[model samples]
Structure formats: C-alpha cells, structure tokens
Target: MSSLENILYFQSALGFLANMVLLLFFIFIILDHRPKPMDLISFQLTFVHIMMFLIGGNSWLADIFESLNIKNDIKCKVTFYSSRVMRGLSICITCLLSVAQAVTISPSTSLLAKFKQKHKKYIINALFYIWILNLSVSSDMMFYVVGFTNVSETKQMQVTKSCSLLPMSSIIRGLNFTLSTSRDVFLVAVMLTTSTYMVNILHRHQRKLKHLHSISHLRASPEKRATQTILLLVLVFVVMYWVDIIISLTSFLLWMYDPVILTIQKFVIYAYPTITPLVKISSDKRIINVLKSLQSKCHQIF
Candidate 1:
C-alpha cells in the first residue's frame, strides 16, 4: 500500500480502538451503578465516532464491497451517505455535550439548575430530535452522489475514487448550502455561548473556594475538570469544523479537490473524534482508579 493509504488506515484503526475502549468504559460505569447524564452523552459520542471509523476505514466496508463485486453506484451511495450522516451526528452531539456540561456545572441557584433534576430525560429527548434532523438534512447526499460512470466527465465532481457529486440547479444548490451552513452556525454559536458561561461559572466558583480554603489545599474540583475538558473539546471541534468547511467550499467552487488538501481535510475531520476518547480516559477519576486496581492485581499475580 502507498504511504497515503497507510496513514489513512492508521488513523482509522487508532480512532476505532480508542472509541471502542471508551465505549466499554462507559458501559462498565453504566452497568456498575446509576449512570450520570454526562456518561450517557459520552457513550453516544463514542459510538458515533466508532461508526464513523468503520464506515470511513480505508480497508473496511468499501474494500468488502469491492471484493464482493458490488455495483459501484451502490457502493458510492452507501458509503457517502453513511459518512455524511455520521459527520452530522458528530457535530450535533458535540454541541449537545457542551450545552449539557454547562448545565451540569451551573450553580444550584442559577436558572439552569431546574433542568438538572430532569437532565437525563431531556437529554434522551434532545438526542432523538437531533438524529431525526441530521438524518433528514443529509438525505440530499444520496441524491447528489453517484458512481463515476453515472455522470459525464465534465459535470462530475469527484468525492472519492468511485463516487462523484452530480450538479444540481442553482436554487437547489443555494438552498442546500443555506440549510447546512445554518445548522452548523447555530450549533457552533450554542457551543461558544455555553463554553463562555461555563468559564464564568468556574471563575466565580474558584473565587468562592479561595476564600474558604488555602491555595495549596484547593485542588481542581471534579466539576471544574469536567467543564474544562468539555471546553477543550468544543474549541477543537470549532477549529476542525470551520477548516473542513473552508476546504469543502474551495473544492465546491473549483469543482475539484487537491490530493494534498483532501488528505489534510480528512486529518482535520477525524482529529476531534480521535482525541475525544483519549481526553476522557485521562481525565475521569473513576477510570484512573480502575486502572490502578488492575495494575495492583497484575503485580499480585506476578
């Protein structure tokens, strides 16, 4: 395999394994005791990332289809449509996570506190709506994407080796772009707003804690750490999301993708999902305690 293909496979494999581990950890937590709303959100996010890796893997389903001699058009529609839906879910879930964490860390006296008691129910309902919205919004992919042989050479906008996007009328194209851009912009705006609110709350909280405890005794609280981690994820998502958008727009306007740019785009696209599980594993105290327990057991065996 070429170096490019190798790198793609490496990314897909690494992300798949990391998300799987994170998902298992969440499952352990949920099954062991009452699962928190945060845990549920995280579990869903990890699952989405896993699906993304599986669908987009360099040597996975696409290769399977090729080996089975599936029709190229069927392959294009299935792969592209699935990948697009997962991408939509990734952003929506990330946004939901940010908002949920903000609410999680809100002061009890604050207005957001009321929802805390019912957060799990609200989260479940929100997730249902998000899935329906994204699934419907991305339905256009199935219509516009086709096998390379289905479209004329001049009209083809290649997305993959076998898949190309068929051109649409100007009105349809404009409306599609508007719908997609509006959804992304609204979600990102919500993420930023919630992130700022969380930071303010943390600052006020630290000040109060400072008055009650010595500086050395005031370790980072679990709430603060969780908020910080979610903030970091939001920042990463925003950066990657816009960069992906820019690349997509440039390619759309030119009706062609530069190979190097495409590679970089995929890197940017996968970076957030790849890093999220690692961040959670490192930050969660429960996971750390479990790891320590396992290590002690291993030493005893030796």
Candidate 2:
C-alpha cells in the first residue's frame, strides 16, 4: 500500500478500537443500572462511529466484498447506503446528546426541567424518530450509487474504487441538497443553542462555587465534568462537521472529486469519532475509576 493508504488504514483502526472500548464501557454502565440519560446516547454514538469506520474504512470493505464474490452493484449500493445512513445517525445522535445534556443540567424550575423526570422516554422516542428520518433522508444513496467501472463519465462521482455516485437531474439534485442542508442546519442550530445555554449555566455555577468557597476547596461535581466534556465534544464535532460540509460543497460545485481532497475529507470525517472516546475516557471520572480499579486488581493478582 501507498503511504496515504497506510495512514488512512491506521486512522480507521485507531478510531474503531477506541469506539469499541467506549461502547463496552457504556454497556457496562447501562447494565449496572447506573446509566445517566446521556449514557444511552453515548452508547448509540459509539456504535454509529464503529459502523462508520467499518463501512468507510478507506474502501477496504469494497476489496473484501470483491474477494467474497459479491456482485459489484449490490456491494456498491449496500456500502454507500449504509455509510450514508450511519453518517446521518452520527450527526443526529450528537445533536441529541447536546440537547439531552442541556435538559439534564437545567434548573429544576426551568421549562426544560419538566422533561427531566421523563427524559428517558423522550430520548427513546427521539431516537426512534431520528432513525426513521435519517433512513428516509439517505435513501437517495441506493439510487445514485453504482459500481465504478472507470467509465470516464462526468455524471459519476467516484466515491470509492468500487462505488460511484450517478448523477441525477438538476431538480432532483436541488431537492436532495435542500433537504440535506435543511436537516443539518436545524440540527446544528439546536446543538449550538443548547451549548450556549450550557455555557451560561456553567458560568453562573462557577460564580456560585466561588462565592461558597476558596478556589482550592472547590471541586467539580460529576455533572459539571460530564457537561464540560460534552461541550468540548460538541465544539470538536461542529468544527469537523463544517469542514466536511465545505469539502462536500467544493466537490459538488466542481462536479468532480479530487483524490487528495477526498482523502482529506475522510480524515476530517473520522477526526471527531477518534477523539470522542479519548476525551470521554479522560474526563469521565466513572470510566477513570473503573480503569484504576481494574489496574489495582491486576496488580494484586500478579
């Protein structure tokens, strides 16, 4: 493999492993009956990311499918459709994560606080709807993707070595773009609004903490820590998400995909998923404590 290919594979491997570990931790949390409202969301996010890596892993799966004697069109359709669905789910879940955290930290008298007692039900319902929406929104992938044959066709947007996006009519393209852009804009707007609210709450909370005690005596609560971690995640996600969008827009305008640009876009796409698990592992006291306890037990056994 070329250097670029090697690097991309390494990136995919790292992200897949990190997400897997985080998924396991979230599962443990849920099974132990100690899960916070956001735990379920995080678990779903981790799973979606894992799927992202598996489906879009530098088109490695394409080669595997070929080796397995899968038909070209079937493989292309399956791969692209699944990839689009997972990508949609990632953004939706991340947005939901931010909103859920905002509700979680809302003051008891606040409007959002009413949902707190029944937040799990609301979250479950939201997830169901999100799945339905994304599945429908990304349905276009099945129609547009085909097995690449190096046909030198302008209407085909080469996605992987094996899969290309077949062009649609101007009206169809416009409709698809409008729907996609609208969905993304609405989700991102919600994410940012909640994030801003969280910042305000954190700021006011810091003031109260300062009034109550000296800096040395003040410690962050678990809730504060989780909120801060999520804020950081949201910031990272928004940056990466926009970068991906800009690349997509550039690709669309040019009506072509430059290989180098496509590679960079993939890197940007996976950046958030790779960093998310590391950030959560470091910032979450629960995960940290679990790791420490496991280490202690290992030492005693040795």
Candidate 3:
C-alpha cells in the first residue's frame, strides 16, 4: 500500500473511534435527561454525520479493494445526499450556537437580547426551519448523484465506488455552487461578528470582576463561561473549516492529490464532532455527574 492509502485508512479509523465516542456521549446525555429539542438535534447531527463519513469512507475503501482484484461497488444518491444534508445542518447548528452565545453576552437592554429572551420557546421551530432549508437545498443531490461504474472490462484503479455528478446545465451547477458557498460564508460571517462582540464582553466582564475574583482569577459567571466555551468552539471550527475549504478548492483548481492535504482535510472535518461533546459535557454539570456515576458503577462491576 502506498502512503496515501495508509493515510486514508488511518483517517477512517480515527473517524470511527471519534464516532463511537460521540455516540456514547449522545446516549449518556439522552439517558441523563428527557432530551430537549436542541439535544436531540445535536444527537442527530453527530450520529448521522459520522455515519455519512463512514459510508463515504467505505466507498473509498471499495476502490482500494477493486484495485486488489476484489469486486465491490456500492454508491447511491441517498448516501451522497444524506451526507450533504447532514453537513449543512452541522454548519447551521454551529452558526446558531454562536448566535445564542453572543445573545447571552449581550446587554439585556439590547433589541437582539430582548428578542432572544422572548423567542426562547420558539427555538425548536427555528431549528426545524433550518432543517427544512438544508433538506431543500440538498434535494438536488438525490437526482444528480449517481454511482460510479467501471468503464473498462477489467477493474483497475477504482479504489472507491465514487458517485459522479449527473450532467446538468451549467446554470444549475453554478446556482448550486453559489447557494452552498453563500450559506457557509454567511454563517461564518455571523460567527465572526458575534465572536468579536463576545471578546469585548469578556474583556469588560473580566475587568469588572478582577478585584472580587479569587486565587486563579478564573472564576467566571455562567454566562461568561458558556460564551467562552462557545467562542472556543467557533474559533476552532473556523480555523479547521477554512483550511479544509482552501485545501479542497485548491486541490480542485490544481487537480492535485496531495495526501497530507487530504489527511488534514479529513481531520479538520472530523475535529468539530470529536470536540463538541467534550466541550458540552464539560459545560453541563448534569452530564459530568452522570459520567462520574457511570464510571463508578463500571468500577464496581469490574
């Protein structure tokens, strides 16, 4: 196996491990409480996105097996479109989370702050709309994505049963690309604006509480803590996402297959789902308590 193949396997295995951990995190969170709408959404996103990655990864591995004289070809529009929908939802959730955190740190007198307070009950409805929008945006994939088939009599160099985009009008492809890129750019812009505001808020908060604070000087209000956690998530996400996007775009533009870039791309894509659960559980006392109790019970059983 070449270096690229080895890296591909490594990336796949890493994603599998991260998915298993996130799966457990979701299970424990659900078991710990009657899952709220947002909780359910997180669970759905984590589970579905990871599964999509696995399916995509398996599709790639099928290509590898074919190269080695094995017969395998599995690719369909459902898997392709499902992944796109889940990815869009993931991006949407991150934007929403950043907005929520920014709202928390906003002065209660602000109109945005007031709106958030008044519409707290409507969060699920808003999220539902987001789901609907993503589904609608990705619906085209169902018709356009088709399983890649062997072009020759003998299988060669088909390391994956990749899907080919169906021939469509240039106008339609351009529109689709524009729409998807706009969605990502818009959310990223939202996150950056809110994140800048949050930094100012945290600075002021820290200054105001400086004298009254304890030894480590790290004691922060719950709102501040939550905002900080979210800021961290957003920062990490932006860095990973943009780097992945840049590499991806460049690779397409240059028609290059650099393994390092490919590995980094997968890692960047996987980073958020891998890190989100840890951040969430750390932020929630209930999750921590449940985790501790479970750990103690496992000890007792062993």
Candidate 4:
C-alpha cells in the first residue's frame, strides 16, 4: 500500500462521516418546520454534501479495482458525471441566492425592487431550471470523462484506473478546458458581481441614514445580517476556487508529482462542503436555536 492509497482511504472515511452529519442536520431542519429561505438553504446544503460524497468516493472506488485497466464503463460514467451535475447546480444555487438578495434589496423605484416579493412563489420553477441546465451541460462529461489507466512509460509508477478526463490530444484538451472553465468562470463572476452589488447597496443605504444608532438605522437588521452571511459565503468560495485553479495550473506545469499540492487540492475540494453547514449555523438564528434546543435535550438525557 502507498501513501496515495492511505490518503485516499482517510479522505473517504472522513468525508463519509461529515456527509452523515450533514444528512442529520438536513433532517433536523425539516423536522423543525422552518419556512422558506432556511428550508431552501438547508436543501441546498444537503445537495452539497451529497456532491462531496459522490466526488470524494472516487478514491475508495478506485481502490476497489486492483488493476489499472478501466474502460468506458457505465458505472464510472455515472459517478463522475453526476458529481459534475451537482457541482454546477451548487454554484448556480449560490449565484441565485446572491442575485435574489440583490434584487430584493434594490432601491424602491428600481425595476427589480419588488422582484423578490413578487416572484417568491416561483422559487420551485427557478430551481427546476437550475437542475435541468446543470444536468444538460454536464451530460458531455460522461462522454469525455472515464476511468483511465495511467501508465508511465518513462518512470516506474503505479498504474491506476482513476476517474479522470480521457487521454486526449492537445486540441481536445484546449477545447475542454476552454468550454468547461469558461462556464465556471461565468458563474463565479456572476456570483461575485451580485455579491458586490448587494454590498454596495447596503453601504449606500447606511450612508443615507441620519442616525447610525437609531432604530430607523437598525430596521434592516435582518437584511444586514443576511448580507454579511452571503458576503462571507462568497469570500470563502472565491478563495477556495481561485486557489484551486492556481494550483491546478501550477501542477499542470510541474515535472514531478508533488504530493503536497495533491493533498492540499483534495482537502480544498471538500473544504467548502465541510465548512458550509457550520457557517450556516453560525449565521442563521433559526438553525442556531434548533441546535441549541437539541443540545439542551441531549444534556438532560445524559
């Protein structure tokens, strides 16, 4: 057994435990009977946990086949492409949340000022589009991605059939990189832009108010809190994703295998999902209260 296998085993085990915790949290939220936004965010977090599980399990699944002769198998395709679907949807969900809040908080006379109030009922329809759009775009992943045997001719390396992109020529590689990363870039850009716009709106509103300590200034406390939470979420996502992109580019240029980068990359892949629930709990009063009540009951039982 190599360090790679060991790390993979550790990652899968750790991720499984985290995923279960998230599942329990989701169930608890639903049982708590909260309404609208919290419920929606809880469901979204549940999807994120599932996404991490599906992607992280690749390590364990790779270890199952002792040899490195993976082909274009249907099972491999399902596992690999399904994760893509969830990944895309996760990003879109965040983008929607950011933009929705932006619209909700727009100046009263603006065109989209009442968009949130008017269209809150159509959230289900919006979510359906997110799922369909992600699933459709990610369909190409099943064809291009597969379990491939990495056989090194120049050096002695273990041949493993890991879930990765097909061994393609330079042209194909360029095309894939351009198309996929372009989509990701667009989504991330929209997310960040909307977040910034929301922040700007809040700042402007604060400046226009006469008294900072007056209740008039504090009437939008909920909005202020929500903005802060969304800003934190956006910051975390940007830092993690951009660093991952940088490391990916550097790794592509490197000559030898650096386990450090590989390890960091793997950890970062799971970092957002792991931190997401905790972040939500810290920022959300409803989830916080629910957790506190559960804690009190547990203490009494023990």
Best-matching candidate per TM-score: 2
What TM-score goes with each of the models? Answer: 0.92, 0.92, 0.76, 0.77
Which candidate order results from sorting by TM-score in descending order?
2, 1, 4, 3
> Could you give candidate 3's per-residue lDDT for residues 1-302 as a string of tens digits?
36755765676666566666656867877886676544555566567557656765656655655687653222355556667787788888888877766665687777677756544455667678988998888877567655655425322222123544445565775676677778899999999999998898888768767756644467567777777778888888888888877875675443345445656666677677667666766686655677688899999999
lDDT of 2 at 276: 92
Output the TM-score of candidate 2. 0.92
Model 1 lDDT tens row, 1-302 = 26876786688778888899888788878988798998888888999999888777635776788899998788888888888899999999999999999889888999999999999999999999988988888888698888886445558777776678888776777777788888899999999999999999988888888877857457898888899999999999999999999998788766775567777788788888898988888888888786687789999999
How far in Å is the alpha carbon of 37 misplaced in model 4? Answer: 3.6
Q: CA lDDT of each candidate?
A: 0.85, 0.86, 0.68, 0.66
Q: Per-residue lDDT for 28-110 in model 2, tens only?
A: 78887777778889999999999999888636766787789988988888887888899899999999999999999999989
> Could you give me the TM-score of model 4 versus the true structure?
0.77
Badly placed stretches (over 4 Å) of model 3 are: 1-23, 34-41, 59-74, 116-120, 150-161, 167-170, 211-216, 251-264, 278-286, 299-302
Per candidate, the number of residue pairs that clash is: 0, 0, 4, 0
What residue runs in model 1 are displaced by over 4 Å at the alpha carbon? 1-5, 67-69, 150-154, 214-217, 293-302
Model 3 weakest 10-residue run by lDDT? 151-160
Best by lDDT: 2
**Candidate 4 lDDT, tens digit per residue, 1-302?**
37755765576566556656556666786676655653565477566666666665665455554355454365577666767677777677777777776776778888777675655565667777888888888887566554445636423221124434544555765666678778878989998888888888888778777455554545557778887777787778778888877776665433234555666676676666666666666666766676688899999999
